[model samples]
Target: MAPIELKELKDQLQELLERGFIRLSVSPWGAQVLFVKKKDGSMRLCIDYRELNKITIRNCYPLPRIDDLFDQLQGAMHFFKIDLRSGYNQLRVKEQDISKTAFRTRYGHYEFLVMPFGLTNAPAEKLYAKFSMCEFWLSSVAFLGHIVSAEGITMDPAKVEAITKWPRMTSVTEVRSFLGLAGYYRRFVKVSHVWPYP
Candidate 1:
């Protein structure tokens, strides 16, 4: 992380404590925070919960399809995305399970009073009640690895560029990841042979 990023993260941690989202943790287990650049060029804080997730059982729930979601929104006139900030943090973790979400920052060790990210069933457990499966209507919205808008659904140009410049896959996991990306936009190449699908 850059010096600026380090400062921003410290400020973010202080804010999280002030906001009562986290508390000084004395837990034996701890996770590290991962920062990533968002689309708007702002730093987004995330926790790497790979070790914890490996031991947790997954919820066998199916998320609704993007195409099916769009089909429902076909005739709607008004469109605006419901933007929630620190969405996962809005939900409280069980008192006993709070220790599981404890994380370490450069500043200090802290545990989440609210739900933390990277839990296998976190989204389903927290946001499931308020969840609505609807396709986003925007100038250009990334939907399921593809871009969609009023002009119609299309492959994201970045993904196309990656596909063209991408190296040959050596491992099964790499092949699956590559094929999974191509599979979404395969309709564009095989059916329409064009940029946007009608």
Candidate 2:
């Protein structure tokens, strides 16, 4: 990891520790944490649970589609998007399953007391809990990259412009990363802005 990212991780972990989001643990299963840069220029820590997810049973519950979610807001004059900071931290992992979510960092081994990002079923499990009583409401506040408002959804010009400045993708990973951001806001801008979607 870059020095800056390592610093960010340390800071994040410190806050999590203070809030009891995680606890030191020794477990048979452990995943390494991965970090990504957010558009806000912040680091988001994720556990690479790919291997674990492969063996875990998938949740049958499906999250409502974002487009469908948006449709529900039509003709509505009000919209309130609550930004939940460390929102997942508010969710408690079942005691028995907490061990399964254990992760190791250079600093120490820890397991989440709350939901951690990257679990395949996490979105499904927390969808209703996070959004309940909150439709026209949202879980994470940022939908498809645009911040929702009572005035309705609108894209930030800086973000729309940044998409134009990204270099051409050279790999599948790069393509996924680009699409994950651009695809969510495709209707906000021209499809051509993020061409060659796979």
Candidate 3:
């Protein structure tokens, strides 16, 4: 780690400790720490939880469908895009599960008191009901990669641009991957049904 990043990591750890989000741990489990560069060029601390996630039971909670969420917006004249800051931190780790979320930093080892991102079973739906931190829009808003409004949904321009510039598929796997991505926005395409791969 660079000296500056090491300092930032220590500062972040201290802040988390002060906020009661994490505590000193002597758990047998330890996951790796990751420092991701944020848009502002600051380090965003992340935990590499792949090994833990492999052992954790998957949460089978059904997430709301994007189509259904858009359906609910049909009659609404206003839209509020809720952005949860440190959303995962808002949920508590179960008493028995806290040790499982432990990770080591250069400073020391610590475990999360709150749920952290990258956990397989961390259901986020309940967090939406807890806060009003959001931006209000009069008619339309970009959501789940689509611009939605009372006027109806349209593919976000960026998504359309991606589809346009998608590399030509040379392999079966690539074709499947392209189809899977394009299929997500199939509603935006005019319905001339038959698609034969030429």
- Against the true structure, whose TM-score is highest? 3
Which is the better candidate, 1 or 2, if ranked by TM-score? 1
Put the candidates in lDDT order, highest first: 3, 1, 2
Q: lDDT winner among the candidates?
A: 3
User: How high a TM-score does candidate 3 get?
Assistant: 0.75
Per residue, candidate 3 scores C-alpha lDDT tens digits across 46-131 of 99999998987787778788889888878777777777878889899899999999998889999999999888978766674335
Give one digit per residue, the lDDT tens place, for model 1 in 1-198: 778888988988989899999999999989988788998998888888999999998878887887798676555444555445567887898999989998888889998899877787887333432336343444556656666566666687898999898897778888788777777666677554544221
1 versus 2: better lDDT goes to: 1
User: Candidate 3 — which residues are off by over 4 angstroms?
Assistant: 1-8, 36-43, 123-133, 166-180, 191-198
Instruction: Tell me the lDDT of model 3 at 6.
Output: 89
Say which prediction, candidate 2 or candidate 3, comes out ahead on TM-score: 3
Best-to-worst ranking by TM-score: 3, 1, 2
Each candidate structure's TM-score, on Cα atoms with residue i matched to residue i, is 0.70, 0.66, 0.75
Off by over 4 Å in 1: 65-80, 124-142, 145-152, 157-183, 191-198
Q: What does candidate 2's lDDT look like per residue over 77-110, in tens digits?
A: 5556544545566678899999999999888899
> Model 3, residue 36: what's the lDDT?
93
